[model samples]
Target: MKIGLYFGTFNPIHTGHMIIANHLAEHSDLDQVWMVVTPHNPHKQKNTLLDDYHRLEMVHLATKDFPKLQPSDVEFKLPQPNYTVNTLAHLQEKYPQHTFSLIMGEDNLNSLHKWKNYEVILQNHSIYVYPRLASGEIDAQFINHPKIHRIGAPVIEISSTFIRESIKNKKNVVPLLPEKVWHYIDHNLFYKK
Candidate 1:
């Protein structure tokens, strides 16, 4: 089985995420996309992040309908300030039978060299990179790597920041999240102080 690891904080899962997972599953060689919910991403701010378990739950709720897409709390059990290299190593040790690939945006691809053990990651794992508007051209140095692939999936501008601000301002976010997910967030007063 070929699995694509779609890692994210998913402060609150939304439709755009689902669309990307579905798009990858249908268009790429990947048979499944595991939405790996990170407890803390070393590259991003951690101050405003929701609880790891809660974020995982939101991802689960949002992706339940797509059998090809699954929500995984794999990084939760691992160490904090989760690093992709470590997670990939652990996953390989845990699931030897399944082939794994990295799923990310072109923006991340541009900064791949700064990541921990990036050379090893690119040499060992295939990457499915979805283009993001205004992300700038993916660096040729990184894109030239044999394992990297530039995906043609349509870009969606939806972002977790936008959703958080909407909730904070008591604005409508129905279009950003799934029906069940919106209800869950509203009931819990998530992102709303």
Candidate 2:
């Protein structure tokens, strides 16, 4: 089984996230897409994030209906401020039979070189990149690399930070998120600081 790991904070797991994950799952060669919930880095001062469990719950709520999409707390099990290489290693170790790859936007692809052990990651796993309205170009090395596949997926502009700020300002962000996730946020009064 080939699993495309789509990592995100998933503050509320909005429709933009759903579209990308679902599109990759259904359109691409990947058998499934795992929405890896990035847990809050306790050392960071970004108080905007909801608790890790809350974000994980929201991801679960968002992905429950899609059989090809799954919610993963794999990072939560690892130490704080975890790196992608480590997470991929953990997943590989835990599920030895499954083949794991990365699902990232063009924006993230531009910064791939800066990631820890990026060369090792490229050597071991394939990367599926989707289009994004990003400022920088994807790294030249990755442009024609055999391991890198540029997928013709839809570009989603919505951001979780924007949604969180809108909710904090008492704006209606219901349409931006999944129905269950919106309800969960409303019930918990998240981001209404």
Candidate 3:
């Protein structure tokens, strides 16, 4: 089985995450797309994130209906601050029968070189990159890379940052999240100021 690992904080696992995961599963050769919920991303700030277990639960809740979409607590048990390369290594050992690929935004592809042992990741695993607003031109750097492929996924500008701010201000997030996720956020008073 071939698995595409979609790694993120999934602060609340909004609709955008669902859309991409579904798109990947429907369009790609991947057998499954696992939402690898990180306890702490090495490149991002931790203060803005919710509790790791809570974030993981939100992903689990949001993806309950999709059999191809699974929430992974793999990073939770691993060392942190979590690095994608490390998680990939761990997963390879744990699931030797399954071929592991990476599903990420074009933006993340831009920063791949800065990740630990990134060369190894590029050489070994196939990466499916969905387009995102680029901070700069890193595509040119990897244009010749053998393992990277660009995917035609919908461009969703909605982000966890926008969701957090909306919740903080008591604004409607109905359109941005799934109904169950919205209810969970409201019931837990998550991000309430």
**Model 2: pairs clashing at backbone N, Cα or C within 3 Å:** none
Quantify all predictions' global Cα lDDT against the true fold. Answer: 0.88, 0.92, 0.87
- The Cα error of candidate 1 at residue 108, in Å, is 0.7
- In candidate 1, stretches whose alpha carbon ends up further than 4 angstroms from where it belongs are 41-46
Residues 1-193 of candidate 1 have per-residue lDDT tens digits of 9999998889888889888989999999999999998786556767769888888888888888889999999888887766799999999999999989999998888788889999889878999999898787667787567798888998998999999998999899998898988998998988896
The sequence of per-residue lDDT tens digits that candidate 2 reaches over residues 143-189 is 99999998988889999999999999999998999999999999988
Model 2 CA deviation exceeding 4 Å by range: none
Ranking by lDDT: 2, 1, 3
Stretches of candidate 3 exceeding 4 Å from the true structure: 41-46
What is candidate 3's local distance difference test score? 0.87
Cα lDDT of candidate 2 equals 0.92
The predicted structure with the larger TM-score, 1 or 2, is: 2
Better of 1 and 2 by lDDT: 2
Go through the candidates in order and give the C-alpha RMSD of each one to the true structure.
1.8, 0.9, 1.8
TM-score of each: 0.94, 0.97, 0.94
- Residue-pair clashes per prediction, in order, are 0, 0, 0
Best by TM-score: 2
